[model samples]
Target: MKITSDLKYLIIAVIAVFLVVNLSGCGENPTEMQNQPTPYELPDIPGFPKNLNIPADNPMTVEGVELGRYLFYDGRLAGSSHPDSMMTCATCHVQKNAFEAGIDNPRFPGGKTRGLPSAEYPEGKETPHYMLPLFNLVYNHNGYLWNGWVSEENQKLGSEAYGVPAEEPFNFRNLESLVWMTIEAPHEVNGDIEKSVRMIESIDKYPPMFEKAFGTPEVNIDRMSKAIAQFLRSIVSYNSKFHRYLRQEATLSEAELRGHNLFFSEEADCFHCHGGSILMTTNEYFNNAKDSVFNEERDRFVVTGDPLDIGAYKAPSLLNIELTAPYMHDGRFKNLDEVIDFYSEGLVYSEYVHPLMKNVREGGVQLSDQEKEDLKAFLLALTDHQMVNDPAYSKPSDLP
Candidate 1:
């Protein structure tokens, strides 16, 4: 094959096009493609529901996620005496206990020199409003917290959802500041979050993380949050005994199968609120199954000023519902049965109750004791024993 001038030029043109497509990524912005989260796969993630919504800026990658994971467990996010804060993301969300509060404790141990479950019950309400679990958050995006105050999707855009208004105009100068707030929030990591700004500015390890992840030495608030968000996006849990049964990889017992059917059926009415493969939330707002907020407006409403949005809270994912308890926004129901019974008998008939509520003011859906037991069995199936103690996610003892 003798190469003529025309043929050689043609070959070079084709190579150029291929290299362009490979480099800039199909003619679209590399950042745009990076922002979208990867979809959840089933055989791999048994209960895998769907791909999480990744913001255009905070794409998930192995190195970024690993750094975020370390930052998540690092108590330095929380403000303490130089480093004695003892409160990391794991501080409240204890990993072994399914990223929830400790046993016998209804809430996490930090926050609130004067905390209250609701403003109405201000006396000794020091317990946390809810101890958030770290499961399926990649699916929910910013829907992790109980009250759902900070509305960052995969942690970007702004706390103000598109149509939502920002009560405090300059609330977030950028995403990094908000990242600071997430850790600083007493309920979250009890410390001054901005302190991280000065420290990271001086540290060598953090600078490179920012450079590789965000392509800059300027690690602002949004960049910080984006890096943290990468680790969060990586913490998706879907494998479980029940999930395996669903995928036909494992055998489900007679009771487990029966419970499964009842879960989706109308008699249990559980499907309306706790439906889909995730088995708890559908990434929308709900007015509590049989629960209520003392001051509906004061809770999340303080953040999002929609009047009709009173008493509404994000639907929590049911991945590790067994371990993450006392349940509900107020932590009112102590156990699953108490939670079930609240739906069964204690549901307060109110105009504001979640329209999905089976036991809505229309006398609500009624489930017998046996049916309740069956539903509880189904909920237990959602638990993942492998996740609670994943060595990859446990605390790093070597870190000081």
Candidate 2:
């Protein structure tokens, strides 16, 4: 039958309505669409690795990083509002010190960080090991901390005693796990996760920020962990003098150039673990013959359960090494000079000493005083002054 114009329009309208109703369910979830965060693109640093360790479940986002930065510096993150009682990631990880408590840190004398004082311990609990600088961590696939404990390779579930449920996100893996672990660790914030979550949820500023970041205003430990991890990953440090030299934007001094040659050459032998990458780390652990005995319960051996890993610890990235003083896993050396001296002449023999220490039999590399000074110049060239002074990584001035 031939349809009238009015009849044809009505039929078309009815069909359109039916299509809309049916297709709506098939489309992306409106709630999820609304919660979709803006993707945060990391800067394309020169000679830096493209493969970041960002988790698939928690992708980096502009909103997430902003929220993470706030959470990172918020002293109230410890579930406490009191000035004396509060603790934060920034309490120990100061940006000026390359996110490490510097040797001169008054709070942590000699750069040895400790948690807030508690009734059980009036002096406050000291961290098991010294702080590692928080930068270029996105490139670190070999695991984290001195012993490579919190890693994707690790299958250990979180402890029920600590309120961490045996779940996907709660497992000892990735930077997200590291965040929650820090909150509960006695030597860190020593905080209760539930209380921390409730406190953040009660805050006026966070819920909206959380919604912007993760699609909902519901503040949980998982989201908090993911957010903080994003911020930590965002802390890149590739703008050092050496990096500029690589980019042809700057040149090194005579001593720095000589030191650079020594560093990459077998004579100085620093490149075995700390060279060959812009990230400046092999991301592997080593027993660098600091002592003849191994008794530290938390050494790499504890993680691997291998006899060879008895005294092994991570060879940290040398980026901004100038600022991250009181060197080594235990903060044994107070300055670069001391570290250079140790590797130069103070190498202690150990049964578990890494084979990389070829000159261990001769006590050390045995460099001259002039060579030592030159080596330090090259190390200092790795310092990214821009990173430490960058306002973006700094604590928000208006934090509540």
Candidate 3:
């Protein structure tokens, strides 16, 4: 397992994570090779947390996070026909409900839909969108689902279903060709992207495991979408309990340090777009208040068709976010005191609000009920509990 052209020149600090996991030949060769790129000097990923993103054609290793946790619990490489009702990606990602993203919310496969996602249907077929829990999924900045429409140009690993845009889908170019037409997109793993590219062309150990996680031994369709985008770029997350009280190694009591000082004070300006060190958002997109899931919409007019992306999404990543609750972007607030009373006083004040959602109708972010239980005790100290029981992203111990 060694080819090292100085480790494929480690993609020179991940040239946009190898142009977002080598999106179709990462080429048009403009010549920038100061020795290819090597960013993952690597550490802290045990249950992941030191703010992870990695892409320069996928930089982290331990054999590409053990083959992206065996292609994230392989549903025989989800494109279809392998179905004995075996819909992998942990059949709606449940690592103890932290991977809660909904594939389509029929109260997710039955009931209780926080981030909705619970498939395994065949007896009647209805579930979708109840599965949005991939837990700070490598520091969430809009890529997965719930109208956020999958991101980073469907980071490779080839059954070919790639496309992304924030939210609003009543068939936008047939849901952007259902992200590379799910290769056999009869409707989510129904199967036939050329028989899922001939089921990885009769897998002889997946062509040197896609040439040892993609230096390229060849598989087709952008190296099988860069080996399922190198197993979802190895889903990273930070060590929580507010990152050991933001690395003072641990100490936040007193109502989670006064809800982490009114969430990085300036009187709750809430760290201007949920700032770095694993708040992991800030790619820029907001609408803050006024987001009743785009109620017959206008404003943040759905990801800047202008008219202000109406209720602009993607400001997630409060890490483990109190175990991914019934929050926003259509999950609708159920706690964190109704998400701090919708950021204190149901924010709707707009001209597309989010100037850190200021003075919501004049009395905003003023916060009470003891500062909304000190901002839900500083968002339950960004809960980590060893990345929700990391048996290396659980439920796949040689699955039966």
**Top model number, lDDT:** 2
| Candidate lDDT values, in order | 0.60, 0.91, 0.53
Q: List the residue pairs that clash in candidate 2.
A: none
Question: lDDT ranking from best to worst?
Answer: 2, 1, 3
**What RMSD does each model have against the real structure?**
6.6, 3.6, 20.5
> CA shift at 52, candidate 1, in angstroms?
2.7
**lDDT per residue (tens digit) for residues 1-400 in model 2:** 9999999999999999999998887685877876789999999976789889998998999999999999999988998888887888999999999999998998989999887788876888899899899998888888999999988899988777666777766778899898888888778888878889988899999999999999889999999999999999999998999999999999999999999999999998999989969788999999998999888988999999999998999999999999998999998898899999999999999889999999999999999989999999999999999999999899999985
The C-alpha local distance difference test score for the whole of candidate 1 amounts to 0.60
Rate residue 174 of model 2 by lDDT: 91
What is the clash count of model 2?
0
**Candidate 3's error at 176, in angstroms?**
14
Off by over 4 Å in 2: 1-28, 160-163
Off by over 4 Å in 3: 1-135, 138-147, 151-216, 219-221, 224-230, 236-238, 242-252, 257-286, 289-311, 320-348, 351-359, 368-380, 383-400
Clashes of 1: 8
Clashing pairs in 1: 79-191, 175-221, 175-222, 176-221, 176-222, 177-221, 358-365, 359-364
